[model samples]
Target: MELKEKLNILADSAKYDASCSSSGSMRKGEIGSAHISGICHSFSADGRCISLLKILLTNVCIFDCKYCLNRRSNNIKRAMFTPEEICTITLNFYKRNYIEGLFLSSGIIKSPDYTMEQIIKTVELLRYKYHFGGYIHAKAIPGANMYLLKKLGSLVDRMSANVELPTEDGLKLLAPDKSSDKVSKIMQYVKNSQNKNFVPAGQSTQMIIGASRETDLDIMQKAEDMYQNYKLKRVFYSAYIPVNQDKCLPSLITPPLKRENRLYETDWLLRYYGFKVSDLLDDDNPNLNILVDPKASWALKHLDEFPKEINKASYQDLLRVPGIGVKSAKRIIKSRQYFRLEFKDLKRMGVVLKRSKYFITCNGKFDLNKEFLKKEFIEANLVLGEKANSSSNIYQLELFHE
Candidate 1:
């Protein structure tokens, strides 16, 4: 098929792979600049605006991963882009200022090594032949040769190997060809190859949520293990979007978007806030409280920790208070050094007093209405508050073409 048609097909197929974070990269290309902070519009570190050409090299696959849209059993129009074609597309797009970088992934064709070679050739053409230094994020094919993985890592700024499912049983049932051990080994290889030029942005992986029977606690524990053991930069969560009818797949019409958002929030807590997996969940309560955020849920469960003195609280203590994020906590600390802060000052400093006022006291004075101070009332309010703040997007799915 022609390249534009292929682009649409492959890009749509690649949307399921959510490991496309662009943090931890800094480079001055011949055309544009890639900051160390990040390059993508979403999950950007330094708030720098940038776009990526997110597409797959090919939509043809040999493995019939039950949960995947590009599986071999799925009768979909297939497309593959030659390495030179990809380099040309990237350069032309970059020249037009359409995108700053590329996020390339692909399904296996011929063999793992051959498929990986095709991906690496695209990167090689972009970097050496075209002298394109824009940020590149490539996926390391699981079970591909270690040499190819290293070579690809050397060419791209960021590399990732997706651990698609959370549990081994899920892998066995849905995706038999993919093994957790292979994905883990590839991640270890990337972590060990953190030199000056090779994958300078570090590595990340993705986990498909709601596809299997794994609990939220189980997923969080696995993420914790990946962070500690692999030293991964990020663990992305993609809620299952069931497109094909299969006995192994869940019968869902819509994606578990709320679950995905809550997972992202919980992940932020684990990464930024000093929160453990156990702190957010227990043996009895496995799923996250979707009505309230993870931090707010924690605060409600441990009410004794509430009414923390804002003036006397440490920076860490301030972080524990609901609605006081990292920036607000730092602001509180910095502003407190100059003079005592009051409720108005907290609002000026960017604290979300609507949530924090219930958990904090300014100079030993509770400013909330005494009638709404009950735990049940506060919980109900938080739920309503979440619904009021939630927003949804509607995406029109393109008609299937062959």
Candidate 2:
């Protein structure tokens, strides 16, 4: 087949593997379709999701991981593009103002080592041979030889290996052919390259949510480890959309988007809000609280910890308050020294007191819950847009965008 025809076949094939940060309801991604979440997020001189000419180098594999459509044993049509062909496509796309670079991934063509070699060659040809320096995002095959990984590390702007599933058991059941250990080792290897922060952009990985019996706790534990140990920029969670659901996978009931959103919120708390994984989950309660954001839930569960004075509170203590985010807490430290803060100043400082009020005290007074008996009443009174109501009540709120 011709290069564009093979490109079409392979790009269509690459969209189903869900390690990407896809947002739109895209059924497939070809050249003209531009909004894939995991590609080269650069813009043209014209601003668009036109950074990377994202495509697969090939769709032929030698391993039959059951969750993957391109698994070796699956009786699907196959295709491969050479390094020269890929260079031609990326250069053509770049010249036409279609993309800034290329995002390349592939199935295991012969062995992990051979596949890694081919993927690396494609990026190196674009970078060295063609003097193309835009941006390249490569997916390093987890079990590929280490030498190839070190070489590819220096060539691309970013790299990833899909964690595929949250738990070892889930991986064993769904993608029985891939290894969590091998994937983790690669993440660590990439992290080790950041001594002088040489690999400045850092690394990221994706986990498949709702694929197995693992809870949000399970996913977050691994995510925490990846952040602490591997120093990953982000650990993406792809909702399991059941492309190849066998009886072994979980029941396909609801769209996994809600659970996916919950995970993203939890991840946000861990990275920015100083939350520990145990703060969200425990040995008894293994799942995240679906009713509130993880921070709010943590605050509600530990009510004895509340009504903290905004004036006397430490930075670490301020972070523990439900509605006070990192940005808001920092602002309070600076602004409060100039004046004794009132209920109005907290709002001006961008604290969402509808969610934050029950947990904090202004000059040692709690208007929202003076009695402090009805946790149910407090929970019920809290509506999402209560801050925007502009009504006069104890729950009247004030906040700003920072």
Candidate 3:
């Protein structure tokens, strides 16, 4: 087939992998060209954000991963770009200012080593032959040779080996060919090899949510372990998009976008808010409350700890508040040194007063007028257009966009 045909097929094929941030919009019109056709945005080593030409080396697979569109059993159109062809396309795209980098991933073509070699060759051509100095994020094949990984790491700006599912049982049931141990070993290799010359932007991994019977708590526990063990830069959660008919998978038409968002919120809490996985949920409540964010849920659950004086609270305490972000928390710490903060001052400092007011106090006085029962508070928060509502707005926003 022609290169353009391959590009179209492979680009569409690449969309299923959610390892990078995607501006989920299809802005195709008589105007500018920002349509979501495999063009994705990623951050650079120096924090300069750039768009990447996200595509797959091939969509032909050896292993039959049941959830994947390009599984061996799936009768989908397949395409593979030669390394030279990929380099030429990347260079041409770069010259036209279409993208600043490339994000390359591939299905196992013949073997993991062969696939890795093809990926490496493409990167090599881009770097040496084309003299392309742009960012490249490459996926390391799970059981590929260590030397190929080292070479790929040397060439790419960021490297990731996706932990496709959350738990071992999930992996065994859904992707029996993929070993979690192999993926972990690759992660450890990248973590150990990270230095000035290798993978400067660090390593990240993607996890498929709701793919199996893994609860939100189970996912978070796995995420925490990955962070602590592999020292990953980020654990991206891709809500399971049902594409094939399988007995093992959930029978859902829509992706669990809300659940995915909640997981992200919990991830933010764990990474920045100093929240442990155990602190977010227990055995009784294995899932996150979709109506409210994890932070607000935590605050509501531990009401006795609240009405915390903003002026006296530590940085960690400030982060635990429903609406206080890292920036606002830092601002509060710096601004409180100058004067005693009121609720208005908190608002001025970027704290969301509607949600925080129930859990915080200003100048030793409660801003909450009446005693709100937990049920009432949750209901009030869930009401549309109320300032207390943030998570539910996601559903409205998705509807508006759709």
In terms of TM-score, the best-performing candidate is 1
Supply candidate 2's per-residue lDDT for 323: 78
lDDT (Cα, tens digit) per residue for candidate 3, span 1-402:
999999999987887666653232222222123333335455656343447778999999999988998899999899899999998888788777767567899999999999999999999887777677766788999899999999999887779988888888999999988999999999999999888568766788988987899999889998999899877878999888898999998887567787888899999999999999999888999988766678877877787787789999999998998878999999999998999899888888889876677778888887766566364664467343243345445565544443
Q: Put down candidate 1 lDDT per residue, 100-197, tens digits, no spaces.
A: 68999999998999999999988988887778878899989998999998899888888888888889898999999999999999989888878768
Estimate candidate 1's RMSD in Å. Answer: 4.9
Which is the leading candidate under lDDT? 1
Instruction: Give each model a TM-score.
Output: 0.93, 0.82, 0.88
Quote the positional error of residue 321 for candidate 3 in Å: 0.3
Deviation (Å) of 396 in candidate 3: 9.3
TM-score of 1: 0.93
Can you tell me which runs of candidate 3 are displaced by over 4 Å? Answer: 21-50, 370-375, 382-402
lDDT of each: 0.84, 0.74, 0.81
For model 2, residues 305-348, the per-residue Cα lDDT tens digits are 88789888988889988778899999988888888787898998
Superposed by TM-score, candidate 3 places the C-alpha of residue 70 at a distance from the truth, in angstroms, of: 0.5
